[model samples]
Target: MPRRRQAVTIRHVAADAGVSLQTVSRVINKEPNVRPEMMERVQASIAKLGYVPSIAAQRMAGSRSYLIVALNDRERTIAGWRNREGTDWVDQMLLGGMLTCAEHGYRLLVELVDTHNDHIARELLGAIAAIRPDGVILTPPHSDNPHITQLLEAQGISFARIGSVKPGAGFAVAMDDAGAARLATDHLIALGHRRIGFIAGPNEYELSGRRVDGWRAAMAAADLPTDHLLEQGDFGLASGRAATLALLDGPVSPTAIIASSDQMALATLELARERGLEVPADLSIVSFDDTPIVRFVHPSLTAVVQPIADVTAHAISLVIAEQAGQSPSTAPVIVPATMAVRASTGAPGAARPGGGEAQGYAGPPAGAGIVTEVSSDH
Candidate 1:
């Protein structure tokens, strides 16, 4: 049997550097007021001896656990979002949080709690006690839940909210969802779409209302009536498909439709094909989120590109800063969104007297333009 190498310890480094163990510990922890020459000697000895600091020991020396917990709601079912892999937004947020945590020498713990459950506070409180996280991050519907925030506050825990526009208390990071939705609507309007339809997400999310308000604003500005142009969806493909069918079968059909999410937008595309409508020729479409699915689909969708990953990273950074005894920023952090126009949108077809499009009326291609930053106040 071959002999196994022994693990290196701080004692080895301390002896090698001809310094006391306490001096080596102070140097390793980067404590203030250490002599520059002594610090250099300790570091060189540690490197030469291949000595690695144990996380357990580091925690014992500090008041922080250097761990953050990100809580997401499992009860909110976004249609066609989850698969064997995972949902796009959740995966993106995890990546952002994990990457940021690694950079700060911290660990990220992701938990899915059912916010809809009556006993959710009790369940979450138990988890908090077990994990004893240094901070927490709340995502979507969970971010808006007052009970969760109240419990965290009662426990004297630090936390940050992601994707929340009006995070009543505590730190928050979000993009201008209303402005993003308005940008999508304006894209269709610029392409000569007068009767534009909107498919909104579920009412459970505050963002859904913000998006609807944006659509209404755009329609009102263009002097267009929005009486029968809006349909409700649950942010799922099935709801989107059903809403599209309802909108198309109605007396007043829209030439262009903006679905609140990429999944719903794809559903709209599928339904349009079944109805024998040629994309951008007979109808135009725009979706939000600009997820990876939009790029790979045939007749790639025009979408509002919200910076989900960046917003999540910012939230995690805020939590870390707060845990490190830094004061939170007085103003909320707002990220901006852009528009990615592709083959899915163009000028509306000329309408006949009976609401049918005239043949050989292929619309011009959509122009590439940037979505300006609209004010976040809306």
Candidate 2:
């Protein structure tokens, strides 16, 4: 039988680095005021010795699980929105969390919870008992759920929140969703779009309301009326398409439309094609979620680039830090969002006799002259 190799220990690392085991322990725990040269020597010895610290041993030595649980709402259906592979927002969040956890020698576990369910607290408690995660990361809907936060607090579990409109207690990370929406709406307004349409996400999610508020704020600032231009959607492609079709068939149609999600924006593009409207000429479009799909689509969508992955990663980091005995910040960590102007938006056109463009305004230089194979079916 072959002999198994003995695992490297802190004593070995100390001997190799010419330091005490206590020094090795302090360096591994990332304590402050360690001599720089000694710290570097210890780190180099650890690398050269290929010593993989046992998370369990570390936990036993101090107090930690080195595990994180991310709770997301499973009731929110994506439907046709995620038909195109790799565009799912959940996938993005998971990827970000996993990567960040791996870097910190921590494991990430994802759990789906139906916050709307009557026994959600019980179910969450059961899951927590089974996993016993060091910390938890709450996604939208769950992020704002007071019950979940209270449960965590009562159980003595640390948690971080992502995408909460009113983040309360513990570590939280979120982007300025309403500000991003306002930026998108203002872009259309700047391009001479007065009668602009908005397709909003479902009201159950707090972010949906924040986005609506942003759109309303921008229109009000521009002295534009929004009563007739706003439409509600379920954050799905079908709802976006239906809402957009109804908006087009309404008594007064908008020259430019902004949908809450990239999938919704794609629906707007499809509907415009069905109605024989040329993108950026007959009708301009803007949307949120700068996912990878938006970049490859015909007339690449102009979108509010919400830092979904970044926020998730930051949320994981915050929980990890909190679990490591760091005090949680009272204020949420706010990530900034930016606009990615693509081919889909342009200056609005003057009215034609039958909703045709009297004058076609060219879009930005980057979007100019980019052609696609979509047919005009009107």
Candidate 3:
């Protein structure tokens, strides 16, 4: 008869390794406090017996596993984004949440709703209820949605927004879009480019409107009339190219164009080349959200630097603070932007005679646009 196979148990491993059951547990669970040599022995015994740890048994032991959930809406576009494997806005939010959860000894779970889903807000709320996480994080424009906001409130769940909501809304860590755009526009004006053109990002994007507002405000302050010189983009390089093409082909071509994002700005350069226009010589340009790639472009981009790290950190802090029973400020914390001027701008030049020639350009380039830098305010 074959020798009887020995049963594998935590006690057997501990005894074989000349240690206590708790020591075996410490080694098995990969927890702290086990002596190195003893841990090795326990592992050797377990290997000798071919022992396997039961996940169900571990869960049944009343061990706590903390988790947090994040909800995002990608229906609108985010500026300064180059779609690689994992650098998008949604990924940033998830990583930020993970960092926050790690600080508090918790896990982060992310759920992405379908862009075409109509009842997304409702479905998201249901997921939250089922998961029952310690807390949740919301990213714009979802954070700005009133219906979703009301639903979260009704459920009595705690959450924080990664971007700004309305003035009276609570718990937001966001960049000041209008302020930053103002700075970008101002940089161009100071550089002497009076025939400035504005390229708007996605219409549905909240920041797009804010940036345009800043552009308009700056122009208005400078006593400049903005009419028919603005074109919209879908926050893609292709959109930027098309918008710029349209602007250049029109009768009154602007000497400088301010793209809402860097990808769009780069696209503007490509279009300018195709149209036989030289950057900073014939047509200066500026873009927003200074991504790393901007510096590597043929003409290093003149941009509005957005602090991604700060925004992420602030959002994490807000969510954790909300979970700790400390309420975040009702006012959104606005991060400042900076003017990273490079080779894309210069002084204004003579506009094509009779500004009416540029009838369809949407807005005029007359005033200073707001530019902001990163900040750490609650």
Candidate 4:
């Protein structure tokens, strides 16, 4: 007759090790104050018996684990938001969240979602039900989405937004887009640029709107005319190039141009080159989001630098505090922008019209183009 197969159990581990069940339980659970030798013995016995703790049993015992789920909009991609090559906002966000979680003995889960559909909140709700995370972190357009916000609220799932929200929202951590835009505009105005043009980003994002609004407000406050010189782009390099061309070819061109992002600003520079126009001397230019590569270009770009790491850190802190049952901070931080000057801007010396070309500093004449150093607080 075949030998009877032995049943495997926690009791078997205790019996085989000649220890009581309570000692084995303490060892298996990693409870505090277990003797070193006793823990070793219990572990050895558990290995011998092939004893595995059942997750189901732990859940039924009224114990719950902490989890944080981060949700990002899949439709939009943020430059310098990745972890590779240069400093990325995503890595900083993860780092801050991980550090906070480790300190509080919590777990973090990341989720990327597409915002094209109308029911993203529904999908997020499903994820919440499946993972049962303590809270969720929303980024970009998703933070402004009313559907997801309502669902998360109705379900009693705590959530934090990673970008600036309208005034009166309880919890959000983000840079002041309008404030940043005002600073960028102020920089150009101080540099003697009266005919300043703005290249607007996509209208789909709230940041885009806020940035443009800030530009208008600043220009008006400075007694500058807000006229047809402004053009809109889709926040892509190509769109920026097209918009730059439009503004340049118009009857009333601006002496200086502010592209909403580094990518768009780079495109403007490229367009200036294609049109045989010069930078700074002929047409001063500035961009936002002092991304890493902006400094490495042929002519370092003048830009408004956002405090990416600080913004993300604040967001993570809020999320972790709520997860750990701590009172949330009163107001979301509105980080300031730094104005980084490089070779991309100059005093308004070039004539707008009449005396021939788009009169401004046109780099070095023709083939003798001079490369300039880029300055950024990256």
Query: Per model, how many backbone clashes are there?
Result: 1, 0, 36, 4
lDDT of each: 0.80, 0.80, 0.67, 0.72
- Clash list (residue pairs), candidate 4: 281-360, 281-361, 282-360, 282-361
The candidate, 1 or 4, that scores higher on lDDT is: 1
Q: Evaluated with TM-score, which candidate comes out highest? A: 2
lDDT ranking, high to low? 1, 2, 4, 3
TM-score between model 4 and native: 0.72
Tens digits of per-residue lDDT for model 3 on 212-321? 99899888877665675699997678899989987887666788888997779989988888788756667888888676677667656678776655676676666656
Query: Cα lDDT for residue 5, model 1?
Result: 96
Q: Model 4, 372: alpha-carbon shift in Å?
A: 14
Model 2 lDDT on a 0 to 1 scale: 0.80
lDDT of 4 by residue, 1-378 (tens): 999977677678889888987787666555567889988998888787787765444345434445678787664443324523344445666777777655544557778787778777677778887888767877777777777777887877777877757653437777788887787777778777888899998776678888888899889999999787789998668899989988988877887899987878999998888877767767788888777788778567878776666676677667656644578775766766676767677767655455333334322333444433222222
Error of 2 at 311 (Å): 1.3
Ranking under TM-score, best-scoring first? 2, 1, 4, 3
Runs in model 2 lying further than 4 Å from the true structure: 18-22, 31-35, 76-88, 350-378
Which has the better TM-score: candidate 2, or candidate 4?
2
Q: Which segments of candidate 1 are over 4 A away from where they belong?
A: 1-53, 76-82, 350-378
**What lDDT is reached at residue 334 by model 1?**
80
